[model samples]
Target: MPAKPRILFCHCNYARVVPDEVKSSVLEGLCKSGQAFDAVADLCEMAARRDPALKRLAAGESPVKIAACYPRAVKWLFGGCQAPLNAEHTEVVNMRELNAEDATNTVLNKTLTPNLPADGSVAKVEGEKKI
Candidate 1:
């Protein structure tokens, strides 16, 4: 059997980007399911601090599922910290867009779907501008 993708949960503690109920629900589900997972208070803070955990998480060959705000944002955040995730082996469940149940279900699901957008997902291009 293929190895199960590692689960990474972002609490988004500093910013209120992710709804309180959604984060709470997803966390509850994860705890109830008894599946081992890594939870961080905030991804943005981790990136700002250049946390080594990000590198550790991105170092392995196994796929990873990250429950966070936006796929694009998460992608860039990881890249900014020099721990860029594999675009083909990472999945970000957008808690901002997905309800608690949907986010929780997707994270728990065994199917691995690489949802991280391609390069420039964060407007890194020379001409790209944030509107």
Candidate 2:
């Protein structure tokens, strides 16, 4: 079996779009589901500062799924980091608009399924059509 993608949940410390209780609920659900993940206070700032943890995450070959705000904002935040994250190998979940249950469901569905495109390309799970 392929390795499971790492799930990263952003608390959006500064913006405060995703509430702390929501984040906690999602994290607890993920843990109970046997999915491994990391909860970060602020992914944008971490990427901006080139934090070592971010570097380590970037260096990994496994795909990554980020649960945060808008997809565009996540992309912009990671843009300045030293290590490059190929767009194909990443996925973003819009936690800003989703409740804790919905966010957890999205993360679990993406990480636990064999949803990658047959062409060996990266795809984003946004709506009905995978991007």
Estimate, for each residue in 4-27, the C-alpha lDDT of model 2 and write its tens digit: 678887777887667776677777
After aligning candidate 2 to the native by TM-score, how far in Å is the CA of 4 from where it should be? Answer: 2.2
User: What is the C-alpha lDDT profile of model 1 across 7-94, one tens digit per residue?
Assistant: 9999999878789999999999999998999999999888777777888977789989999988888988888767889887898999
Candidate 1 runs further than 4 Å off: 120-131
Best by TM-score: 1
User: What local lDDT does model 1 show for residue 123?
Assistant: 28
How well does candidate 1 match the true structure in TM-score terms? Answer: 0.88
- Residue 127 lDDT (model 2): 54
* C-alpha TM-score for every candidate: 0.88, 0.70
Worst 10 residues of 2 by lDDT: 114-123
How many steric overlaps are in each model, in order?
A: 0, 0
Error of 2 at 131 (Å): 36
What lDDT does candidate 1 reach at residue 36? Answer: 94
In model 2, which runs have C-alpha deviations exceeding 4 angstroms? Answer: 110-131
